[model samples]
Target: MDGLIDRVETERKLRNVWHWLPDAVSEFPIETWAELNVTVADSNAPYRPVTRFESLLQKTTTVRYLRPEVALMEPCFDVLYRQVHDGVDVTLIDRPNCHTYFLSTYPERSSELLQQDNFTVLEHDELPPYGTGLLDERVTISCYEQESGTVQAVIDTDAPPVRGWAQSVYENYLSDARPIESRL
Candidate 1:
């Protein structure tokens, strides 16, 4: 009863992508905007993180890059731009080809890793609301748990270009969507 790839066991792992740089001092600066929050979901959600990211890109005008996780690089097809970070070549979608990206790290243990490496937590709360303006407008940066545990960062936004983005995300992407918790 065994065959070549016929076992066909489709295993799922959560993934994530940050909207900030590796050395970013803080999270997306929440200025005159409304609110900020973090969200989570199951691995079998109807929409993939990349699909959500692509939707965001299509709605916005400035989003021009996406640095996806190592695991999803092959699935993240037809990106417009590519960049090399720490000896790892990453792909990003920009402008007309805008897309999403994920990091190959865990948001929960990000704080601990920061001291060991030049990493920053992508949590929704710790991100200084008054520090650097990492995001020009509200953008949803998303990812999955380190070990495919849960879907992290769904409502990851700085300032929503339009109202109801959170609501929209909840409806389309989130399952539990715990607010103001540090997943990264």
Candidate 2:
């Protein structure tokens, strides 16, 4: 801790990406936009302090990422994620207009691990107001349903032309990282 950047400075560095996106967007559920707030925690990295981020969807479609605690519990799904579940809630405001499919690959693990052995898509209202993943951490999706809320029609994880991304940035704030007397 003595030789590294402090927590305050780390938060500023982590927020670099959040502050870099567009300011507003339209086409949202309530005709309103959200402030982007997300948790910056790499597999082995320390948790960065929460900060609000914003990305414009259209002229009025903007979603603000916020809070890490909410993600671990009930995901707004507005952020990057992969979910695995046995089932999902069917009751919602609006439902998906089209049929969707979920694929399962056995190369990674055993089929017996899959509780339901199927992919489930929940209703739009059943999901959070923000973006979210159809599947949990497992290779399969949860219950299958209709949706059209703030959630995307379909998110392509492997798509190359997709928009929106979050990455970490490090900064140097220590007054003296190295002793001036030593130079190598």
Candidate 3:
């Protein structure tokens, strides 16, 4: 593959990407999701439950507040994970320093309809522009430059699941909020 992102590497990256997505999104099967150049993990923290991620925002020298997709990618991966079987093994290969289009599709086998594909845009130098078609109301990205290191990413607002984040975060906070009670 010309762009060639390692399967394992992508899986790991995919997992990291989920941090940007909304918590309302469903979880992907770890085994299956491990196929892509990116994958999702338990995080193990459990303390910081995911809610409205608001996308990924980082400021770096290479890029600026560029695209919203990049910001929402974390939650996006969560949704994607459910759609792909053995996706963890699937490498999201693409050319370096390029832009690509990611289309949403419905696989006959799976029921969920919100899945995205990563395409490398070597033909284009800049990252691909955001699309309005994804599950979100408006998906976008913004990038900013840093003097020395780090890239800044900004995300626009999107509709949360009808239930919203308040309930989930509250539940988590309450469940573990209390100090451990001991019965003598």
List the global CA lDDT of all models: 0.31, 0.22, 0.28
Encode model 1's per-residue lDDT on 24-141: one tens digit a residue: 3133232312243433344675345445454443344333223233333333332312111122122122111111122233332322323332222122212211111112255454
Largest lDDT belongs to which candidate? 1
lDDT of 1 at 148: 47
Question: Which portions of model 1 show Cα errors greater than 4 Å?
Answer: 1-34, 37-39, 43-48, 64-67, 70-136, 148-151, 160-184
RMSD for all candidates, in order, please.
17.3, 21.4, 20.9
Question: Which candidate ranks first by TM-score, i.e. highest?
Answer: 1
Q: Write the per-residue lDDT of candidate 2 for residues 64-162, one digit (tens) a residue.
A: 211112222123232211222323321111123211111122323222222332322222312223332212111100111114211111111211111
Evaluate residue 43 in candidate 2 and report its C-alpha lDDT on the 0 to 100 scale.
40
Look at candidate 2 and tell me the lDDT of residue 16. Answer: 34
Q: Which candidate order results from sorting by TM-score in descending order?
A: 1, 3, 2
Quality of model 1 by C-alpha lDDT? 0.31
Candidate 1, TM-score vs. the true structure?
0.31
Clashes of each: 12, 29, 54
The weakest ten consecutive residues by lDDT in model 2 span 166-175
